[model samples]
Target: MKKAVAVILLAFALTGCGEPKIDGSSEQAFQTSMQKVRDSLAEDKRAAFNDAIQVIAFSQVSMKELMQAGSGDEGGRALIDKKIKGALAGKTGEEVIDYAHKIKQERAANQ
Candidate 1:
């Protein structure tokens, strides 16, 4: 689940700037759209979403680099975008965040 979130985050970060060849939305619009998605999520999910955003915000990764990685690589980027969207389809934000938290708790217990 962590891996899934990481992938989604990476993909989202990569695709956020709106690849000219792959995405039609502008960067501002893409951010707005993502915010809307987060807003639509339930409270718990919103918290998790906020946490994820914070992580991304604090990370040293350069969004410009991420965007460059996605550009000129339509196939990989498009596939990841599609898969992440499909995997998240119909899932409530709360459920996704709860699952992630559950996994974290179990991992901590095991350790």
Candidate 2:
């Protein structure tokens, strides 16, 4: 699972770093989005992630699977990160379950 996440984050980071000037707003958005994900998990969903380390909380599935399930486009990292933001802002519980379910389903599909 961690391997899958590393691959996804690698692909995500590589795709974004293609240019010399990185967009500052997007980076800020990612930071905010990541924080929201951590906070939401810590506050309402204990099963999702650890709030202290600011990393993925769920150990059962890879983030790639969750993004695939949530966005269904294999979207870019920023886009997927935004989706998670949306989950945290609007539909916290449902989105988390959706992410988890989709992660498992996607992972199984690949295996």
Candidate 3:
């Protein structure tokens, strides 16, 4: 009985330790979301939106940090969040994705 219980516990632990799924569904969803946001943005805001995306792409700050800062709603974090929100306003997901693609192509060409 002891050996059976040990094996069952080990099996459960091993199952939890398996590698996470790497399917691109999450990436696709992200692109879709970006496109939607970009599409909603005003034409005048598109430049700011692109600049904001570039900042995110090039900055050392992690997305989690940015999200946390935005949510904090105090001090410099609030200011940062406001600026980012302003830039992103009225943008669509498609434009975001396209901008990312453009950045990728530019990087590739430079390399």
Better of 1 and 3 by lDDT: 3
- Candidate with better lDDT, 1 vs 2: 1
Quantify all predictions' global Cα lDDT against the true fold. 0.52, 0.49, 0.55
- Number of the predicted model whose TM-score against the real structure is largest: 1
Question: Model 3 shows how many backbone clashes?
Answer: 15
What tens digits encode model 2's per-residue C-alpha lDDT throughout 2-90?
Answer: 99999999999898553122122465754565455555453555454333122223443367766665775655544555544444443
Q: Is candidate 1 or candidate 3 better by TM-score?
A: 1
lDDT per residue for candidate 1 within 6-74, as digits (tens), equals 999999898755412112144455455556667776666666766644442323235554475468666
Q: Which ten residues in a row have the lowest lDDT in candidate 1?
A: 18-27
Off by over 4 Å in 3: 1-25, 61-111
| Candidate 3 lDDT trough over 10 residues, lowest sum | 18-27
Score every model by TM-score: 0.38, 0.31, 0.33
What local lDDT does model 2 show for residue 97?
52
Reference-based lDDT, residue 6, model 1: 96
